[model samples]
Target: MAERLLIGALKSGKNTKIVTLNGKKMTKMPSTLGKLPRLKTLDLQNNLIPKVCPEISALTQLTVLNLGNNLLEEVPEEMKYLTSLKTLHLFGNRICRIAPGACDGLQNLILLNLNNNQLTELPQEVNRLKSLTCLNINYNQLTSIPRELCFLEDLSELHLNYNQLICIPEEIKFLKKLQKLFLVRNNIEVLPEGICDLKKLRILDIAGNIIQIFPPRFQDLKLREFYCEENPLILMQPFAAKHQENIWSLKEITSRFVLNQLAEENPFLMNAIEHYPEVRSIISGGKNCAICGKFFLTVWLECVQFVPPSKNWKISKNLQLVPLRILLCSYKCFNQRDPNLFGISQE
Candidate 1:
């Protein structure tokens, strides 16, 4: 197709400001695209383009660049000229070497997608993308990440799944804004200290790795999802989590919700309760039963890894709530109640 016609199609009108020509697989971008001076977004994905067309640099107003699923071998040095480009998607490409000073001109880049490439190492120039917030580099040939990457201060989500990573950098703990971390299917060994100090981390997915000792310190975390499956992690340190009555995985989940009615009144020992709806009709936090010596229904709470716009989370219901350990005393047995001895209240 003629380049002028394509640029004419990628125009703005009224309140709209986007144009798409995705999956075109054009070996060459139209030479007439520079005519669309008002263009703000460009999507040219799933193409067979062997190289990043330098003509793209003329579109200085571009904010989005989608050249994914193409046969691209290297991003053109001219790409640095698109300083206004913020989101660049180049996943599933034949890229082997990122041009040096690649991130130098991208002063406002917020999102970068370079997954599924043949990259053996990342360019140190990546640290220059100061405004970058999210990055996706899954299924690559990376051996180790640069330690200077700690400079991505505003980065929130980092996806590095299916890489050849053997160890996590200690400076990674410095990414205070990191919310989600996906470390699945790697060759990592030990986890570093203060790994749990990422107070804002919400989703931590390290499944299918060689993890040994999981940190025994997660009490201060406001976690909502925690997945360490397929690792050699042993028992969770119950005491380290400050569980008052029952064994809790972490702290935040303590008596947050209480179910007060019991169906069987005296639930069978070996038969575990299945789902919540089974006890839904019961009144919550109302009365104690004579047989169970506590509230009729059970109460439970769970945790979630509290990471950021990160792409690391287990697709599981990873909630760990410990039930209150109540004394099973008969009313007649309670007549002989020793409040001080059992720490019971008989007011």
Candidate 2:
């Protein structure tokens, strides 16, 4: 059998640096492979290996291990001894769990692929790989991303598509060096405004979701490839209609039409524009807080109706319809105002 020949060859070459037995239909790894203590690359992809043998730890010099397209159910904990490992490919497997300490000592790892598996959650220990730069966990059942993943400050590329994620955490902004991010085909309803802070992001895929709007600062990003198709993007309707093309520019997305569309969709914004035209004029003229007359990067609209005229007083019906609008830079400013006469809560 091919396994017998592979074991014979490994036993004969004790200093073998590379051993490839890809698509050999291997069910189990022979313990004789441990004799090659100098093995640096081992390729056993496209096999039936149910589990990795602990004896693999004897190959302490292993740097690249490929076990893709197999039936592996869990990562062997003994792999922690392979401190020299840099790239591990476990894609196309039935792996549902990873034993504790499986990645505890893998400090030298730079790329890891666990895609197309049944993993529901990632182990917290994966955060220990400070040297990791690329990671692929696409096509899994993950409902949420671990906040601990933010510790990978050196990471540049992260693929988390085809999962069941409902939201992307604000902590993702910590990946300052990230250049590519793929979140296609998820249940994501909203993207945190913090995503606009990823200055190095060039490719952003957010297709196939129910996202209605993007942060006002999103136009500041200098992305090269932006895939937002297939999403129910209601706020970007004006931009989408005008551009008909796949590519988008920052100017087109941040145009007055798009901004006006976003404001029209919000009840509080519409009320402020309709009832108090001065607030709209002030915002359109410049970026200063209408209430305190201070420069601000963020602001909210709060509207309050005037106290109703006394029954004895005579006033036109049209004059009583106007409401006072207050542009606040923060919630504290809005809280300082007296309650509305109509008891309508500030949004």
Candidate 3:
């Protein structure tokens, strides 16, 4: 019966571009599907097909392919032939592995849905999908994603929910165009400092994680919606404490002096830094005092300031105040800090 339908479809027209054979219960893809060279859309979802036939790769002009809810165990290598593909849906499959070169030919792919699969990790080749904007990998067993995934600068919406992800890469700041991030139901304990660099992020869902505190300057983000539930948040207990006197180590003293010298852009020191990569790295990691504006390394005072929710923000009504972590150069700066900035008690 499926063969007859394929034969009839072939005779339907010479310019036939769309084919809908979903739920046909066909166990194998008919080789005749290759005959539709100009086919732009192929719908073979909700079927028992175990794998995609290599013959389908002949459809070079295919733009959209739906193989959702199929018996596929892996993404076929032939998928690389669909260079013009823009949207590919493989959701609800048992796909556990993707051929390395499978993404090599998908340069124009925009939306990839790999949700509800058995994928444990994404291939580094995913970086080749430079035009991808929306990638859905929810409901998988991914514990850690390849850093290459963060190389997708055009990505705007990322769905990593229902996974075992313990942490997001600090390189996530590379997705400058990212707007919505869903990290719901993960084991993530901390958000990277680089996350604060995503100035375009607006909607964030970090609910159900074990996060106790947000990264520094997290309140600077102009978010419209914030969902942070089911996590153990620290209580806000405003109190007054005196900054204790502390002695600086020899290494700390040298690092502070070098950081100060680098700020003046001394030509000789700048050239010497090129030879000592460690020095350059330490200078880059230097933090400035919030009160005195002095650079410091390895030694600083940690504090928190409460941020009242803005009128335009759509935050949970249960949240009246949010704590933003801050760092100061020394105890002296902590002593002179604004009355609102409170030092976190180590006791």
Candidate 4:
């Protein structure tokens, strides 16, 4: 009956203003919207549409069109007929190209979404959307961004993460109005020198890369949040010279340690002690005998074993022990010791 009523509403020249079908399996909008000549907003979200039907371009009064979360492979060329549109959403589709004239003459377009697609490059025609402010082309197979995007002088927030970008394009430096930039998890080894030019940049994320150093004057910008984690930065001695506000990590690879030629000499010790990067302290200077408090040359880790037990005191503390120590004494000391006490003959 609702379909019949909608048919009567169209047949009687009763113009409709808005059409919303939330959570419905609308594969395509009925051709009635074009005949109304007054329909403005058409929302077709959360549907099982396999592709966008081209007949939607007849809605000349459409100001906002949402087609998110659908199986659309490409933005149809006929969509440019919606000359009065201001906001458009074609996200979560399988689109592979941002065609040259597919979105032409949309002079008032403000917000555009082409995220989560198979797009590898942005066409030069993207620069025609001069009125665009918020643009999201993230989560695609993009290796580099087309320089034409810098034309969106009004764009503020740009999301381009989860792509295979190796470095920030120099054209990106021209976005004077850009506030937030997300370029994490890329193969970048160094940041662009023109980054400080973005005076309005608040959040700059370049984590999970191999960048080991940053500009000395970067703190002059006074950014609110900076993410530079998981880089190959060593001891942050360079950052320690400033006002001490930059957050850094001291975790570096072993190769960062310097090879020092300096040494220290002592008469009591045998060799020249070399300086290591990590050695902090030493407990005892001179060694002492284990049997008595007498001074000795050295103290070593010896593997001693207990002999037979005592007669009355089965486990007396004074039980005999074999001195199976490592290299400390010469052959003369072993040859001169009494065989009865040490249990060792001349051989």
Best-performing candidate as measured by TM-score: 3
lDDT of 4 by residue, 138-257 (tens): 788787777788767877777777777776765676888878877766667656645657777777777666765443234444455566666553321211111112222332111112
Off by over 4 Å in 3: 238-243, 345-347
TM-score of each: 0.64, 0.69, 0.92, 0.61
Question: What's the C-alpha lDDT at position 95 in model 2?
Answer: 86
- Superior candidate under TM-score, 1 versus 4: 1
CA RMSD of all predictions: 17.4, 17.3, 2.1, 23.2
lDDT of 3 by residue, 144-263 (tens): 989899999899999999999999999998999999999999999988988889989988889899987777778877788988888876668876665479789998998898887878
Report clash pairs, candidate 4: none
Local accuracy of candidate 2 as per-residue lDDT tens digits, 1-347: 54575675666678788888899888887677777888999999999989888789887899999999999988779879889999999999998888898888788999999999998888878788889999999999888888789779999999999999998888888999999999989999878767878999888888787775565356567777676667754321111112122233454334333345534485665654677665555446434344454444233443334433234323333323223333444444444545441222422
Tens-digit lDDT string for candidate 1 (1-347): 53643744655432234667676547876655665655678787877778766566777778888888889887668778788989999999988888976677899999999999988888888888889889888998888888767679898888888898898777887888888888888888866544666877887787888865443244445555666667654322322232244433322122222322233343541133345543333433333433334442233321111222223433344423211222332344333443321222222
lDDT of each: 0.64, 0.72, 0.88, 0.59
**lDDT winner between candidates 2 and 3:** 3
After the best TM-score superposition of candidate 1, give how far the Cα of residue 320 lies from its true spot, in angstroms: 8.5
Off by over 4 Å in 1: 2-7, 10-17, 216-219, 234-347
Q: How many clashing pairs in candidate 1?
A: 19
Residue-pair clash count for candidate 4: 0
Enumerate residue pairs that collide in model 3.
none
- Give the candidate number with the greatest lDDT: 3
